[model samples]
Target: MSTVFVVGSLNIDQNIRVRSLPRAGETVRGSDATFSPGGKGGNQAVAAARAGATVKFTGAVGDDAHGRRILEVLSEASIDAGHVRVSGTAATGTAVIAVDDHGENQIIVSPGANSGITAADVDAGLAAVQAGDVLVLQLEIPTALVRQAARTAKGRGAFVILNAAPAPRQIDGLLDDVDLLVVNEQEIQVLAGLAGMPGNHRDLVQALPPALGPAIVCTAGAEGSFTVLDGSLVHVPAATVAARDTTGAGDTFVGYLAASLAGSHRDLPAAMIHATRASAIAVTRTGAMESIPWAHEIPASAPKPATPDPATPNTASPNTALSSPVVPN
Candidate 1:
């Protein structure tokens, strides 16, 4: 098994369920509220660990109770936290999430200590990475730091997988350095600038630049996933399940995808099938990290993989559709 290193943010998620989201200047009563450990980095780290990956986490947290609790949560998930740092000047990062009746979510984040993750932090943590290891990253932390980590990881002969979530505008240069880029429908549109792209497997694959990386995976919630590998495109449909909350589905998908890729199964299509199955299980529950399924808890048989569309055309354009709206938590 290959080790997975995640360099990102750690946040305490404060979640509230309500009948519907309130309009500006309008007030609505929420049904209930709960707090859980969450952050793109932390969530993916936990998800990867639960899916049987040897995972290490590197990020910053505040010297507060939330920070301590976050560490405890990561420890419980068996994620190595030797690279985590605590800062006295800042409070722990927090995300205020509002979920409506339709399993939709809205989120507002306070960066706090997560923004403090520096270049030096990534450099010091590079000692744990080795050849064949997988280094996963997101846009939650500073872009400069992510770039530095990618460069370092690549130099060490490790595969770099970047989940460009919370999409950043300055990600074009970083794509060339990444080994894999996992994104969603909105992200693809933003990167390709193509509108009404049919959300098809081939269309999504043809959208990305081939020289940027060896593979590109585009996740479409409920509709399933699309992947482009070795100049070929494959579409994997999502498993059907009663969704209670869609808060961490994407994170679950990416995390499990990373784990599967690191494991004995190097087949990208098969790994994505497992990832989609894991994410389907995630949407049936509530909360972010709490919803990610453990390896033992996954279904005995995964979903049947979908064949790529042979007749699909290559419609690559610069005028892209609006990015997919994130599910409110």
Candidate 2:
């Protein structure tokens, strides 16, 4: 099994449950309020650990309660947090989230300590990464740092995966360093400059200019996700369940995908299936890290030989979807 390294953000998510998303300046009241340990980096790291990967996270948080909580959560998930830093000058990062009845969510983030990550921070976090390892990145942190890590990981012969969320108006040269690029429909439309691309997943994915770069995975919520493997586009169906919150689905998918590829099952198509199932399970519950399913809880489609060593887990099948009843929202 290959190790998975993440260089990203760590935030305390302030979530509000509302009947529906409020329009601009509408001032709608939330039905309930809650807080959870979240952030693209932290969420993905937790997801990968739950998916049976040996994971390490690198980022910064404030010398505050939120920072302490974030570290505790990561430790409980068995993620290596040695690279996580505490900033003396800044407050911990935070995200104000609103989830509606349909499970859709809107988020407003305050970078805080997340914006303080320097190139040195990225380098320190990636020191443990080696050839055949998997490095996962996201846009919540500084783009330059993400680019630097990607280059470093690629030079070391490790696979680089980027989830370009909060799509930048213009993609930097970092695209060239990515081995796998993951995005949702809204992001693809903006990043690809095809806001009105009127076609199915196959056409949209195929139409992307080579400049977009990397093998792509385009997710379309309940419609499932699309990816290209072995020169063919494959669609992995999202598990059917009543969604409680969609906040962490994308992170779950990216984390599970990285975990799958880091193991013996390097097949992209099979990995996508596993990722999609993990995502489906995520949306069926509320919160981010708390929602991800553990490897033992998920049933794989094809049963591979089990490893005799308890420390190392065997690769599981990708065809099996989540069959358990939905937990109360």
Candidate 3:
């Protein structure tokens, strides 16, 4: 089994359920507030573990109660938290989230300890990654650390999966070191500027610089996901379900995708279907990490066709194809 190393952020999410999202300058009463373990990195780590991967989470948190609780949550999920550091100078990162009846959410983040991650910290985390392992990264922490981690993982021959969320001002060759670039329409737009528009899976893949990596996956909420796999355009439709909270859906998708790719050693298209189904399950519930489903909980509706043959080792050459796009099942 391939191990997953998550180098990112750890945050305590303060969430509240409201009848509807608040309007501009409108203060609306919400249900009792609750706190849960969250953050892009932490959520993806938990999601990957639940999806049946050996996950190691590396990030920083305060020595406070919130930090302790977050660590406890990761431990419960069977994620290795030994690499996570305790920062004395800053508090754990936090996210204030408001979820409406429609399952839509708005989030405001306060990057505290997450911003304190140093190059040394990233170096320590990268030590766990070996060739053929999967390294999951996000932008919740500092960009410099993200680059450092990317370089380290790439150097180690580990598969580098970058979830460029909360889109930075410049992707600026950040994708150069990444093996797989996962993002939504908005994020791709930010990373690629005008080229990233249209946001179609094929278009985004075509627009992205070849140096940014060989494969790209663009997710469009309920509309499903698009990707260029083996020179073909594959679209995986989202599973239908009642949504109670959409938070962490993207993280769920990314986590499951990484696990499927690492565990199954299948091509990008094969992994995407599994991820889309897992994400469909996530939005049906509330909370970030709480909403992510375990491997057994994934529905039968999510197609997992035998491709590249199950008997084959999960190892496949990366970015060896970019032919004309053929529509896949």
Go through the candidates in order and give each one's C-alpha lDDT: 0.81, 0.81, 0.81
Clashing pairs in 1: 105-327, 105-328, 105-329, 106-328, 186-324, 193-318, 193-319, 193-320, 194-320
Q: Give the CA lDDT, 0 to 100, for residue 132 in model 3.
A: 75
Residue ranges of candidate 3 with Cα displaced over 4 Å:
194-202, 209-211, 303-329
Q: Lowest summed-lDDT stretch of 10 residues in model 3?
A: 320-329
Steric collisions counted per model: 9, 0, 0
Mark the regions of model 1 whose C-alpha exceeds 4 Å error after superposition: 23-25, 194-202, 211-214, 313-329
The runs of at least 3 residues in candidate 2 whose Cα sits more than 4 Å from the true structure, single-residue gaps closed, are 194-201, 301-329
Query: Looking at model 2, which ten-residue stretch has the lowest summed lDDT?
Result: 320-329
Candidate 2 per-residue lDDT over residues 65-111, each given as its tens digit: 98999999999999999989899999999999999999999999999
Error of 3 at 178 (Å): 0.3
Q: By the TM-score metric, which is better: model 2 or model 3?
A: 3
Task: Write the candidate numbers in order of decreasing TM-score.
Answer: 1, 3, 2
For residues 212-324, could you state the per-residue lDDT of candidate 3 as single tens digits? 55467788877677665444445676777798899999999999988876684556676788888888889988899889999999877655342332223333233453232
In model 3, the Cα lDDT at residue 87 comes to 93
Query: Across residues 213-292, which tens digit of lDDT does each residue of candidate 1 receive?
Result: 43578898877887654344567888988888889889998899888877876666777888888998898899999999
